[model samples]
Target: MNTLSSYKHDYGPLPSEVSSAIKPIYEELSKEELLERCAGGFTQNNTESLNQLIWKITSKILPAGSKIVEIAAFVAAGTFNEGVLDLLLFMHGMDLMLARNSHEYA
Candidate 1:
């Protein structure tokens, strides 16, 4: 089995599609706002908020299955948007709905 040390993670710049989507939003922000956002990056997405957001989504939206919900919690944590947690909430909700359908039908 593959181990953590052997895993090669591709930590590169965001894909063009993602960058493109955010370009408009980025441009719309004032220079001062952008600077403030940059300064706040380090303090934002704190451990407590991340934990609570993930817990609420995974525990409430995911199916009753332990494994699926656990995986969902982990995945949702990474993709969770500090600026807009609800967006990823919808994403987790979609995943849960899909999992529920497949799981129930299977």
Candidate 2:
């Protein structure tokens, strides 16, 4: 059997240290403070989804300017929260009218 001490000797630090070393951490999670923090059951689903949407709009393969990235984030967030038709609302708010074909597309 691999005991904690033996595992530490063979592999390096304990689980806590290993977890802390990685990005987007998975905690050792036994500590009271850590457990309490996680009691609410938070996860990165929304943030990750927003990032995926933004990347789809802006293209990670191509360099994008700050304004372009900002616009992409806005569009992604608006679409994610309210669907594609939200763009029509935004345009209407700005007094910009869309053609019949554009309305159909929306």
RMSD of each: 17.8, 6.1
Write down the TM-score for model 1.
0.26
Cα lDDT tens digits, model 1, 12-96, are: 4787799799878877774676678778566455676767766676656545677866765666565564334444555667675
lDDT of 1: 0.63
Provide the overall lDDT of each model, using Cα atoms, as 2-decimal numbers. 0.63, 0.79
Q: Over 4 Å off in model 1, which ranges?
A: 1-45, 61-63, 81-106
Residues 1-106 of candidate 2 have per-residue lDDT tens digits of 6785365454645576655677245435565787787779775578898999998999778789999999889888898999988888778878997888778988
For each candidate, what TM-score against the reference?
A: 0.26, 0.57
- lDDT agreement of model 2 with the native: 0.79
Write down the worst ten-residue block by lDDT for model 2. 22-31
Residue 48 of candidate 1: its Cα lDDT?
A: 68
